[model samples]
Target chain A: MKAWLRFSTSIVNKSVISDIMKLFDIDFNILKADITPRGGKMLVEIDGPQASESISYMEDKGIEVTPILKVVKKDTDKCLECGACVSLCPVEAISILDDWDIDIDNQKCIGCGFCISSCPTQAIALME
Target chain B: MKTIEEINQKIKNGDAVVVTAAEMTLIAKDKDIKTVAEEIDVVTTGTFGAMCSSGVFFNFGHSDPPIKMNKTYLNGVEAYSGLAAVDAYLGATQPNHDLDIGLDYGGAHVIEDLVRGKEINLMTEAYGTDCYPLKKIKAPITLENINQATMVNPRNCYQNYAAATNSTQETLYTYLGTLLPNYGNVTYSSAGELSPLLNDPYFQTIGIGTRIFLCGSAGYIIGEGTQHFTEAERHHGVPITPSGTLMLKGDLKKMDSDFVRGATMPSYGPTLFVGAGIPIPILNEDIALRTSISDEDIGCKIFDYGVPRRTRPVIKETNYQELKSGKIEINGREVPTSPLSSYKRAVKVAEELKKWIQKGEFLLSNPVDLLPNKGQLVKPLNIIKPPKMVCDIERKPVIITHPTDPVKEVAKKLVDNDINHLPVVDKNGKLKGIVTSWDIADAVARGKTKLEEVMTKKVIIAREDEPVDIIARRIDKNDISGLPIIDKDNKVKGMITAEDISRLIGKKNNK
Candidate 1:
């Protein structure tokens, strides 16, 4: 299970991850972290039996945890297949196929939200 | 050479071998051009790109008492109502008065909404006249009410376009779309090989009255489009820059929202993304050869859009094959590339057009007149001012020198007058040659004392009536500091040096 965890500016300076490591029986891996003194979000993979318990614990500790079923979703009906998002993917997750249809590899998508903004039709949306 | 009528006859009989521009490229590579020419009858091409110079003219008929509407607004977007009482032209790029710059609703949106069968508010204001008594009117209108909703796009279907990238530190929002800073990404708008104009590069078959698939409906090439510059640099019969465009006209009421889209280019206001295609009749081997040129052969110049100027400098030239590969090397950095034009829609347009022709539902029309290949030039809009002639600029009197004068005397005159050029005249006072300081030094160094030996006989002279700009160009072209201004009789009129022009400019600046 993957989830996006956000910390409030007040709790940003605290070592909440360390607390979770000692408190929860769950195993986790931080997929990506973009944090600042002002506080930001971190995408993490939490696939232990106590993943839900861990998420609830983070919420209780003044952290917002959103379960990530998918990093980005595309409404195929609205996609114009203009290739506006093909190269914006730093990890080469999105591409235009031979038939000119957009193919998104969520495995490679780091949830940068570049494709979401680059799309002219606003078809691609960040999924939480 | 196969005649257009012959191709039409085949099309009518459902026996014409037709293919899309994309298909033609495959066949072209496998078979010889001559074989391809003999095998193919017509090649259909398409492009779904943002064409800014698009609009529609509507005649809303006479209002209640038929008010002479001098101003008209459709859903808050201003439409040009400078024509007759009820006729107005709504441009695609016109921004909505009420909306912000980003994704702002405009006339293009109105057009799309109308095509989608959505009702739009129509408002107008005018001074009451005897013929038209009503002063103001506001009404919700749909595609049903308008008597004439003709889309007369002055320009569409660009032959080729520049790929833009930003080399500056900050991002740039351009008509090409948003270019990330430091050559972050490249955006190109042309469909390359699938583009109609690239298929018929010379506009031999595509001309006035040529039938086309414009925005999902039948359209015609009314005339050569605005900024139809055919003189752009070519690579394999296709332009490497913004060249050859089409002035298309079609029924806006019949167009589909899928093909006729209202697009907002990031922060750069509104523009219509039109889908258009032209079926080229392979009347000759040359046409077949041209239509088959692949994307690898068609090149697009990448320009740095960081500089806010009309003429952006080209950073590098790369073909569509490289551009489509998603990465290109520029300044030793591998920058990613993207396309603003929908190639999928372009293919769909070509496929749709091919289906129409194959089913005998659509027939190709012979152009009444061909597009102009000459005399059409894009005259830049610049500050209007009169030309200043060489005579207008203050210059020194002609320092006369006879051909019989000694080299030492010529050098003395040059040194005393603080002048570099002294025109050497013959016995008849007609200008023969000119001696410069460099020439004097060369004469002394070469131990040649004759005035004829020192003086350059092949003198490049400037005419008094010549425009200052022309003289300046001549000076730069010749790589000289000065020139002797001469009259019709070849007599030295005056001497205009680069220094004199600079001095005059300096004094003018002081004032």
Candidate 2:
């Protein structure tokens, strides 16, 4: 199971992540993280029986935790299909179709959210 | 050879052999231009891309009390209200006045919304006059309520455009979409052979009043577009760079949202993605020859947009064939290429136009005036360097003042020396500030007695040996009529006024 974690300024520097990692014998992998001294967000994949409990532990540490539901969604109405996000997509998940409209393959997408940010019209949304 | 009228007659008769520019390319592969010209009546073309130089002018019928509106805004995005009362021009790229919400919604969205029959927040301000007394208005307006909604794009239908790539270490966001750093990506926007101006490379058939497809609706070519490049060198008949632009006009009410969309570039702001196309009337073999030109034959310079300036270095010259192939090489490194302009949509537009012509719904008009010949020099806006220095032009006595001095004393000194400008100096004769005749008049009008109260405190001073041109520009830009000339120690040595610069021009011209 994948989980989204937000580190607020108060608990941002805490070593509770390492504490949870030690407490749980789960397959843990940090997928993406953007951090500053103030605060930031991170996406992680944690598998095994203690995944849910480890999330609860991080929640108690004041790190906002939410289960990763899906990778990204493209709002077709807002997309101009200009292909501004195609070259910037590292996974080659976003592509232009024969009709010149954009197509996003969630299976190929690593949930990096680069397409969501590179989109000119803010057409892509990360699924909560 | 068939004339435009003959093509129109055939179009109305439902027997015109009209095909798309894309189809024409494939047909021309087997047949020659002369044979194609003899058979085809018209070759339709299309392009859908971000046209930043696009806007709609609205003429809202007068309100109950009527207002000579000088400032107008639609959905918080300001419009150019310089025209008659209640009429305003909303540019496509004009961002919202409310910076927070406006980053997404702007003039382009307003136009798209208006076309979608969505109600807009129409706001206006006026200085109440006798005949037109309404001071302000804030109301909801729809396309149905406005008297006129016309899209008048000053520039569109680029003949061709250079592809853009970045050589820098960081990603670059430009009109050519997002360019990856270190030549990681290349982006181009023209629709190659399908481009309207490219098919009519010499503009033999397209001209003023030539009918066209604008936003999925009928429009007309107005004239030469702004920054219309007449001087670009050509390969065969097509330009190697961005050239020939069209001034376009159409009824906004007839436009479809599918063809006219409001889009925003992540960090680059808003632009209107307009779907446009034009039909080339096969009047002669030349027309057929131009239309037969294909993507592979067209070449475009790839410019390094990494250097942000008026002119960027050309990376290499490549053609649309390689560009559409999805990759190209820069500095011997493989770089992916993307088209910000959708060729699929361009083909769709061309098909739509072709269907319209085949169905006898649209007819071609003979150009009232053809587009002008090419080879107008692409001139840069060069800032001329004037060859005279302040000390070289001649000198005048330094008009000095003290900070604590009274306004009357400065007025007396100005009147005695027949000067209107005075540079305020300190006890050690260092330049402190400046005061003008206008300052004294302002002092009396505001009832100020102290010179410092009326004098400009943060003075703009120039050096004696500096170019008079630089000092003259400084004075003009600062909105001050004069500037104090000081020495290395900051002591006021002299003063140069607008009048002095005017005199220097006369002297230089005479010499």
Candidate 3:
């Protein structure tokens, strides 16, 4: 069943990420955060069976993950063309600003906190 | 009148000139030097070995001559001879700066009180001055200065006094060395790399009878750096004997001399001197002996052979990723599967993943639920399908004659390998009788003439349409191992057994 746990890059940092994964024993992939829009939270997606299991695991650690919210994709209209996020991308997930304000490379991004730390204008964040 | 060699020879012979306190008192009174040596042995046997194991010692005193005095003494003459012997032993045992030494407190007191206090008489020189302030000392008071008003001879006079200042004090001694009143702090933790012997894990297992010499770094690690007539002074300096500068005899002499090579000589100050006969080899082997230098043969041989460095054990970690993957071949094509996959085929991949996670083949952040993803459950073999009927083998009949019987007879009369029972019938075939292996057994047990009488009877059976649970219940209630499979026409078709039921539930007799 291709089941994987997901995490938001906002709260957890890369330093403690490996330790947390080892501690929980969960298999997951990281998805980059899209923070340009105002309301954005951590996004974790899984199939029905694994989704329930992941939620319970998070709950056990007192991390409430109920009433799940939909992942909010970034809008193309808010193009500032600042090109500030390109350098901040740890996994090189953010593309060069040309015709578009910002383009995301989903494959390279590990959904970590690099872009969050680099965002001077606080424009980028993970959407859930 | 005796030379240093002659004195050393006397001490080696175990004879020391002892000058007692009373004799010293008389010498102070008479002011004589000639009769003192004659009255006491040149080297006293009583001071053969040093008193304490280790600590700093000081000597600042002088002694009276023996010409005017006729009696012996223990005051200063005995200790000086002891000091000389100690230095000899230290020079012999640890020629290198390898040995930790004990200090002579008596020597320090004598030097400070007798030599500096009486001979030099600093108090007398500064008596008329009011500029010098009164100083209070917090150490043990062993000796007090008194009665120095007599007109003194050259030997007893303060002019011949030499002061070993704080800097000079550390270097003049070796084994029984001591630091000045305040010479930095003391370290109580492991020193250096903490020699291998003390750090060896198997050290405790060594038996008491083993003559382990605590030598080299091992000696210093275990030894508290205490030796009689020796002190461990933290300061650095050159080694100077009473007669000559041991460290400054030129390159050829220095290269050949082991004693002066490693000796720490203070350039600006005196280093600590330890003068004990305990060698490094002795210290390495006999931990008990090294600690107790007070033992009779503290300087004697502690080990007949030298000890070699011990090797440390190595540890390695193991990997079992291959066995855990459980890769199997399907039509010569390799596919990885978990051992638990065979138990539940629908979630084979999920089971494999779970097994890998458990074996640490892959890291897992949390527990996961198995996903179906259109996975199909493996079906059981058709031969062992659920029972469609319940029949008692003992109740069914075996018909020997008649083919034109009813359809029930026709159905039960078949000579099939799967069917072991049959219903007997007359011309009408109106449920006349049944036959089975048990019927024949009963015929034999009852000593019946033939199977005909025993086989004539009623059949205990259920319809084929009955649920498997109901059929199992009937078999359990009847206490029979097998039953007949009957259709709605009241005719037998097949048979069932406990073995078949057991085979369906994943049970195997071989396993």
Task: List, for all models, the DockQ compared with the true complex.
Answer: 0.43, 0.41, 0.02
TM-score of 1: 0.76
Query: Where does candidate 1 chain B have its weakest 10-residue lDDT segment?
Result: B97-106
Compare candidates 2 and 3 on DockQ and give the better one: 2
lDDT of 3 by residue, B1-511 (tens): 4433443344445453323221233442453334443443311000011111221222323222111111111122112123311110111111111123221212222222232223322210111113323221111222243221111001100000011111111212212221121111010100001111111112221221211111000011121111111111111110011110001001111011101111111111111111111111111222221111111111110110011112111111111122122232223443221110011111122223223323333221111221111222323356565443333222333333332333333334444423545555455533445666555456557676443465646455545454555556556756766555656554555555565555544433455
TM-score of each: 0.76, 0.74, 0.15
- lDDT over C-alpha atoms for residue B434 of model 2: 89
Ranking of candidates on TM-score, top first: 1, 2, 3
Candidate 3, after superposition: displacement of residue B100 in Å? 83
Best model number under TM-score: 1
Fnat, model 1, is 0.67
Order the candidate numbers by DockQ, best to worst: 1, 2, 3
DockQ of 2: 0.41
Distance from true position, residue B308, model 2, in Å?
1.6
- Candidate 2 off by > 4 Å: A1-29, A34-41, A45-70, B383-511
TM-score, A chain, model 2: 0.72
* Residue B136, candidate 2: C-alpha displacement in angstroms: 1.2
Clashes of each: 0, 2, 91
Given candidate 2, what's the lDDT at residue B453?
Answer: 85
Please give, for residues B131-212, the per-residue lDDT of candidate 1 as tens digits.
8889899988889888999999998988899999997655667888778878989999899889999888888898999999
